[model samples]
Target chain A: MKKLINSPDSVIADALRGMAAAHPALSVDHDTRVISRAGGAAQGKVGLVSGGGSGHEPLHGGYVGPGMLDAAVPGEIYTSPVPDQILAATKAADGGAGVLHIVKNYTGDVLNFRMAAELAEDEDIRVSAVVMNDDTAVEDSTFTAGRRGTGATVVAEKIAGAAAAQGADLDAVTRLVTEVNDRSRSFGIALHAGTVPAAGTPGFELGPDEVELGVGIHGEPGRERGSMAPVRDLVAYALEAINADRPVGGDVLVLLNGQGGTPLIELYGAYAEAVDWLEGHGATVTRNLVGNYITSLDQAGFSITVTALDDELVRLWDAPVETPALRWGR
Target chain B: MKKLINSPDSVIADALRGMAAAHPALSVDHDTRVISRAGGAAQGKVGLVSGGGSGHEPLHGGYVGPGMLDAAVPGEIYTSPVPDQILAATKAADGGAGVLHIVKNYTGDVLNFRMAAELAEDEDIRVSAVVMNDDTAVEDSTFTAGRRGTGATVVAEKIAGAAAAQGADLDAVTRLVTEVNDRSRSFGIALHAGTVPAAGTPGFELGPDEVELGVGIHGEPGRERGSMAPVRDLVAYALEAINADRPVGGDVLVLLNGQGGTPLIELYGAYAEAVDWLEGHGATVTRNLVGNYITSLDQAGFSITVTALDDELVRLWDAPVETPALRWGR
Candidate 1:
């Protein structure tokens, strides 16, 4: 388990220090390990915030920007950011217009973020949060965490960021984010496993000939294990699961997401396969995306999310967002 | 050397068939092996095109949409799409507005795209290209492929996708894309190599106690091997390389790219280290992106890309884009 770090425990602290030094425009709350812009966004603008385990790059922290999140709380790799860190983010993002916290649906993430929100309220800072539970891998399942929040986090952040950037009030931004999550559904698969730097080993053992289906981000075992098949069959399985959980509206914002290890070529191949299935089914893919957006550490696989889009949501979706992870029309 | 396919020779063809089945909105030319939207965007709009190997999913193909790219040519995993495929893309994207090819900086990508561009000229379709040679890992030397492009491919795609979406002329779009390539630099590090499905073997070897520095997308050997250090130092090495190569400019767009297998959490961990280094150097991380954008199949590593930005290009970049890969800003 050789890695680029002096010690597993010190990786996060040292990284925070380095980020603080490298980007003068970004200010790091060393005490809390929260990252925000130097002066934070303007006052009177609803502050948008997001936080989670630190492994997903450009997600919580990389997304801290002008048209996006005001600040983000980062936890250690595959670990939740502490309650205190979340509180710090809520406070920094509070611009008198209130704050909205975007959280992915993971047990630790939910608990930690919710606790942070509670702590923020105690501080007299009006903070509202929305949990993104869009992974559609299963329903009424036991053995694992309920449908994991896979790809919807990206949409939530973008839409919420846009609303916040437009000066939408906290309630409005929170509602918008929730609405997007409500309209989104996701399903995932993994070909290989990634290592938790702290654990110093691969998350799971995957025979070279098999891929884990419906795997969670933390290397949670997938729903099924099967021989890797042609891309079309994989698309069929992913779409069947995602489409089954399709939001009521029919119009969908499709996301073909790569788990940590899959390559871009494979992602596109899968996306092409997924879209073909949707089109053949007489379904319309109103908006679509493909890439390694929200990823499980280094698992080799991908997921798909379809967020049904409405005119208002689509407009907000098109709004410029400037984050390290996503920047276009910014 | 474990993979699911029946045979390595069948990978590309099988993948394409699967892609066609999944993405009906995309027309896959079996003969030419090109993937294009079923219907082109505005007829007079300059068409945006890009592509490379099969494993970098969602890249050239997933980017095909309203405000991004019109067509993406794909090759075998980690292999350049042949000249014929590039020609197919050129034809499919040849609306009256001409075409702009966004190519990553690879020896094969360069040779193949250039040859296709020459072929397009013979057909009277005006074609321009911007070769994205952003990786600074391999310094100028006779022993290398001259800086291989890494993460800047995303920046070039997004910005040029915007300009083309805004009805910018082919030349203008091409120029902007080239400028971005010129101003950007990238560096990568890998902990472990991925198994190429086609090759049925690891792309490269890494000792348990070491990692590779300055690697490319084809699983190419990096500049050197060294004992793993703190994530911060690795990031510094990358940022320093990118920063040194970066042209003097205003804001900078930085990308924390995971090679195929590095998990998002690890990518973020790497980001924490890299961004800190970037900030300390007085670089304004105006736009930050962290994810697996450009990748080598399933290699466990990450790369950093920084592109200097100015207001105009930034504004153009802020324009709405809705691709299968990047769908946030519609």
Candidate 2:
């Protein structure tokens, strides 16, 4: 693969170095692969921690800052961080109140984070965990037993992190994160698969005229393959799947995320279709984000994430967030 | 081409619809294809107007906000906007203090913006223009009379837009934009060419192990084509080009821009090398932006821009900007 990396093995380390240089507000622990706030966790607030593979950037790591993740533990590309790495992040984030782990639903990630949580508990640290499985694309995937977590992970990190930053206790923060995940749904489509640097080839291939519907972030098999269609139709299919599973309505927050290689022009185009679909179906979009948040390496695709929102969720989302990936107000 | 668009012919319109849906702070005029501040231009503030082809998203249109452009006129993909559209934007942006046009160095863009300035003059709207030609790759190329403008356009917009928002007159805004362009230098390398939707194919081609160095945003030929190497070598080559054209030293604001398809992970990795190169070369990076700010559709590449900063420029660079692509502070 023609990637801008020194080597496949050094990708995460190199990127962390860059992040540390670019964002002085966040500190990178190169040895442990934990990105945490430069000022350290607040003394009385519950610390927010999230992590996963390295490919989906601006996810766990880029979200670290005030009003967001306190620490992010990144593993190898598409590979879950080991228990040691997660434990390091957990300890770094703990501020005496407690630590909340926001994890995506993947077998490796779930197990690793759980193991880390257990390890943290052995040290007398109270830790609460929320596993996100918002992807409606499939019930199981190559690395997941339940629905693969996708775009909703960003929503969860932001909303729940806001609550944690506002002095919520570990239990309240955990409940908010769980609620965000429960009210969220995501679906993805791929025009092309992302190539792993080590593999030097795309994980899968697509015919010139075909598209993968409901594709997972790691190039896992989706529900089915379909012929190429207009963005409106593609968005409709994604929304239909989400509606079938959750029946979206009322005030909602939306994320039209571009898989790595998709252009912002196309993301905006697709976002228009999503907004049209949502408003036509009686849902009022109160807040929206259109760009790459959780990307799958260099995959060319897009994911639609919808979160049914209440007044409190909306307020939290609008609250100041200072992170590399998602920042506003502050 | 596998793009998330309705049709090649409807790409701009559809994307505009999506932009309107996604950003409530901006107003999009479908008929004129102009994006402007939703709350209208501030009275007595020098209005900033910038525009060009459509594909390089978040450049002209996305920069329209409180601290950036007052209006942006977008043309068809890779095609310069018509004088009428530019004139409309100029008129829309005109406050009592006059307007400034930030034009890239493409031949068509310069000519169109010039003509629009003339039209605005006929309508009694004073307009000043600054043409950016910061690419140090080549003196002249396919669509440019001199050097082609690349990544420095975003720097010019942010710094100069801040001046305009601070109530700088049109002349001062124009001068500051010109200074930004003069102090800045950029170079790009592409692993693959971006495919224009209308063309249905890549603008250019590269062998599996080759890369196009100093490539233009429109896929125009660059300085040379060379075999693929590590990102360090590639970044060194780009910085070398910039340093050769204009010696880089002292405080510098750097932008490591992704050419559409490059992942944020890779961009960050590349950024590390850039920071190392700049520091090693006796330049201190006072500010930096790493992401896809200016893009060329779905091309796999990156461009590095370094602007030598003085105290005033640094202050303006640190000013609040709220745009779809580049945002920080208030």
Candidate 3:
């Protein structure tokens, strides 16, 4: 229960103020907790918007940049933003070109973003959405609608960001983002649990030498929990699961994401192991990223994401993006 | 440490095999451990190279893209790569255009990369290095030798990568990286310690309810350790240190980096807090990033980086880069 935050209730409010201050390119609607780059809208570009729990940061907000999302709405730590917040961000990012919503497959996120999308439709604003359900962690879970959207959310944002920046219409953006979700798969392992500021303690518990496999980002119970194994075995089990579910035997774009606290070197280890497995399985990883892209709050574990890539995705992946989280193009 | 690897001795080896298999675009040399994109390496172009401990994934290696590093050498988790490994990578990346070493400001990393550079020089392959010392955490403690390099290393590699991709000579690349290092500074705090595989325990320790300020990547001892405070106070402390030391009063590029295990949402919170702090203090943030750019394996904490941006650096920062970690240009 020990954390460094001030009053847990003020964490989100304080954080929003800080984000607005750090990037002049971005602004925060403190009243609604909507975050947009200072540029308001992309003039003639398709506006992309995504948001979810506050703890999976840099997702909606960080990706708000040139080739990425125009706006990101954040909820409190590990909670979904309100529907009104999503509406505000959607409106803020909307230009002449229409808007796209990239919602991770979660009950709260789905319900909230969907409600707002319907509201936007009523307002006569063109809005489309692609619900990302790339996590193979839960084939059938009572807590989730279906597969939980874990790490592949990053791929959705990156690909969709690039597409929107290239002047893709809302439909095009939705198509591409959906394509990314369809092509990508993810699974994760947690060695230690995380603290959800409000709960003030580890979301779940493991002994000093324990680990959980096929875990979701929100500390949902994994498929299995056991004594901590070596990184190699861990990677093997994780990669095997992802490989079997998704069959990444084609040109692939991959991301090895930390669920908050796993170190970069360890992620590399997991990546290295996954690479060997993929190659052995006859997969061609054309692009790769080894870092904490999508994460759970300070959870000590990592996840591997594989997006079976096509030439179009490869091209879109290479487009210029200049958001707070991702940027490129001279 | 209760890690999930078969053995500490073979962790790197197994991981390498896995990486090679998962990423066909990035081929790893098991013998020398040099990772590069297949068919990459512009012939006759000055090759940019960087490396450090294995824990900082997507770093020296992930940044190996068109406008960034040509090769990235990895060491054991949180341990520096030996000189022979560095030399091997340098030689492999060497073209007639010479080689540039993007070194971080750590005793082990600097020593290893420096020795490799010297060896390369003796072999008549012109080499230059930009020792990044951007972390303003512990004054005069950014490195065992001097100031430590933290988040700014990304900026250095990115700028240098762009220059090298444009066929800039080694000297020019070195100058560009140096300029970035000079203009940028970073500070970090650790809410928890990290697990170093070899050590099998945390790299450092703090109370469950405590936070450490001014932490280094390798879990190096931070400057201050105190009871965990609120997010605002924590960010304020970090920002004040950076602002006082580096003084980013004008247009600046801000980076809120996760130390391996922090969630993006938390990082966003930190980013938000940092932005507010900067603005409240009369600082103008031009660009911002919040993610796990630079990490300290499995550490539950975050870092903040600020780079004073000008026209040239911004332009260079905006250049296209194609690497496993960052790809913008195809």
Instruction: Please tell me which predicted candidate would have the highest DockQ against the true structure.
Output: 2
Each candidate structure's TM-score, on Cα atoms with residue i matched to residue i, is 0.75, 0.99, 0.83
TM-score of 3: 0.83
Summarize candidate 1's per-residue lDDT along A1-330 as a digit string, tens digits: 866565778766766664664456678888878899788767899888787886665567767776778898888887788898888888888888888888877778888888888888888888888878887776523323566676888888888888877778878888888888888887777777777777988888888668788777777766688777776787688788776666334556777876656666556557667767887776777666656677666556778787877888888877876655566673
TM-score of 1: 0.75
DockQ of candidate 2 relative to the true structure? 0.87
Model 2 segments beyond 4 Å from truth? none
Weakest ten-residue segment in model 3 chain B by summed lDDT = B321-330
What lDDT tens digits, residue by residue, belong to model 1 across residues B127-203?
88887777777754222366776678888888887888777888888889888887888888888887777567787
lDDT of 1: 0.74
Q: What's the CA error at residue A148 for candidate 1, in Å?
A: 4.5
Highest lDDT model number:
2
**Deviation of model 2 at A326, angstroms:** 1.0
| C-alpha DockQ of every model | 0.31, 0.87, 0.42
Give per-residue CA lDDT, model 2, range B1-330, as digits (tens).
788989999999999999998898899999989899998878899988999998998787988887788899998998999999999898888887898999999999999999999999999999899999999998999989999998888999998888987878888888899999999999999999999999999999899999999999999999899999999999999999999989999999999999999999999999999999999999999899999999999999999999999999999988998988777894
